[model samples]
Target: MQIYKNLLLKNQTQSFIDDKKHEKIVVSNIQSRKNPEDKEDFSKLALANYLDEDTGFNPLGITAYKMNYFLPFAYSFGSLGNDNRKMEMKFQLSIKKRLFENLFGLNEKYYIGYTQTSWWQNYKHSSPFRETNYQPEFFVDFPLENHSFFNNLRLGILHESNGKGDENLESRSWNRIYASTAIFYERFLFVPRIWYRIPEKRKDDDNPDIRHYLGNFDLNLGYLGKDYFANIMLRNNLNLRRNKGAIQVDIGYDIFNNGIYWYLQYFNGYGESLIDYNRKLQRLSTGFLISY
Candidate 1:
């Protein structure tokens, strides 16, 4: 079993007088996970969460699914202090694929996904609550010049279920479209991204979560910086009717490899889901990695 980790420590200094605000305290996480959430596999925690001398896997990341798969599972975790903690688990799987193969209107992408997030008392929520989401989606991807420019383009629709309650929850689905283009020279590359989500409101009087729509764009750059090794990313986003969104994006530099090697990263602004509204945008994290 391979493992990875990303750990970061924030300066204790507070940006404002409100000590309760998220300033100070270390931010650590696993950007991607290779393993699922199974009690028999708590070992995944060492690599998925933080540095745990006992666990053998990398401190970050979990095993992810393959390309043609409809849904994807993403893993991440963090804590402001020993007492304040948060954890999340997500499962996304593809349903209908290669439908009609070449049929234009009949061919479509379909998927199902669910997510659960929990919080523990420390500084944030006094009582922890779980938000659940049920989603069905359709998408298409186009391949551009493989080694040159515009290697791929994609678009899709996402149906979201009510997150507040289990039963009273209503199914809230929406249509979303996204496009990606990349230019590559040797190992260095740059990719551009654009996406829009058209959320529909529910007429049901029982509707508790208000639905909304949004548009966002992002650009990323990658450099082979060196042969057999490359690193670079630039991403930005804009949400309608909300403050400017922000985030930190970068991977590790595994140049120096020794016994017990590790990986690390720092990110804020923009949560996991490109559509997450309440996710924070400031934090630092670092941890060891395995197998690079």
Candidate 2:
């Protein structure tokens, strides 16, 4: 049913005007919790909220909206890291549309987007640079694009600018790279992933080693099934070296009518990040989401 044909066949000849028509909105939370082993009664915490929208009939044919907020409290668990509390807030909006569409391949689609931001950072005595930071990012989403056995198998990129050292935060920009390629195996998602920390090309080199090591594995089970869901992630960081990883599991049941989803989660693993990977303690984190 995907037989529109590749634009390449046209040999750069066509009576084409950009086709624009669409709308969308999204809300999501990115959470960073203290590693339980961090044992320091006070652990680092960061919460990021994001909102984005897209529309048509305009230059580039798109409009965007986004915002982020963070709070890092000072606390201690005896020998854990000392509290020197810090927090930051950020907001941004961007717009873009296709400069060109279906210019190269069969059933190919591409678009351009631009984003900007405003923010504030406060801490003990507060940061001296009390001004809005500026950053920009580009993005692309492709479905069924593996190029090989995985070709057209689903691939995409979400990236942003970079943040400052521990002294600063990400406001107008944040640079994160994430990609996913998945296939339904017996109705379950089988995906392999890899992620790395970008050397904030702009940070002071006081601690060059600040760049964390890369390489980790993430696994998901029973993705399309209603009765079970599980996830596992592993990473290596300065906090702990070798064999320190995090794992999470969830099990839920769907109520037939009323269109409500209810579920209980079982979170037992070394805490996330290197600092929380204690073999002795496993915390239980549970929550639910309702959709109408």
Candidate 3:
């Protein structure tokens, strides 16, 4: 009788442990279903890793360089010319790869980045692409330590162009050398950048006065929250009499508590695209952002 009682007690304890384990597994699965990317920080994860861990050294790890989003319904508020439509689709793809890290023992990292943005007139009659801007850049990032205000600095040279021939008078392109810094305070981020446009030949210049519209400096301010984020970009040419620039606002919400966000963007002013560098307009767009 004593042996039977002991055996029964042990069995009950084992059963209780099993039940707890099963409950934990079920809860984990439910949480995973709710937020699939919770275990991995999807927003910061590199989009591609060509080398495996066993390789020990990865020289070609590619990551998202800027906001990668697809805006299916971007509607302009004002006039957009006779042939262009008011509503269209827009998308951007940006990526970067680290070339060297701390090569000079200064903790400076070098990288190459490429970004492409396209404005598609999908709602138009023949669904022609309005404009596509391609930007390729090389930069060095220096991380600061014990800095009270600024945390990082970057210096880069960038070239952006609309893939258009000069024959039709539709060519637009620019080259710039820029310096930017990053400041962080709690959940807020501030980035200020200044750039100098490289000179082009008289015959090659498509937009000579582009600097007046796009400005020499720009400010980016962002607020990050647990389930939402917002960013405001401001640019000013700083002309005393004929001040001109642009403003863009972007807000994103994680409605399902997932990594993917529903994004809204508002832009007013010039330089929305290479072709529209000198044209001022207002646009409101809704989209989805996989990485920010």
Each candidate: RMSD:
19.9, 16.6, 7.7
How far in Å is the alpha carbon of 26 misplaced in model 3? 12
lDDT of each: 0.37, 0.35, 0.83
lDDT of candidate 3 over 54-126, digit per residue (tens): 2335355776678889999999998788579899999999888878788889888888999999999999889
For candidate 1, write residues 47-68 as lDDT tens digits: 2221112334533422221111
Residue-level lDDT for 83 in candidate 3: 74
Query: TM-score, each model?
Result: 0.44, 0.41, 0.82
Error of 2 at 92 (Å): 19
Please give the range of 10 consecutive residues that has the lowest summed lDDT in model 1: 64-73
Candidate 1 lDDT at 262 equals 29
Best candidate (score: TM-score): 3
Model 1 spans with C-alpha error above 4 angstroms? 1-83, 86-137, 145-147, 159-175, 202-215, 224-243, 253-261, 270-276, 287-292
Model 1 Cα displacement at 213 (Å)?
11
Clashes of 2: 18
Clashes per candidate, residues 3 or more apart or on different chains: 39, 18, 0
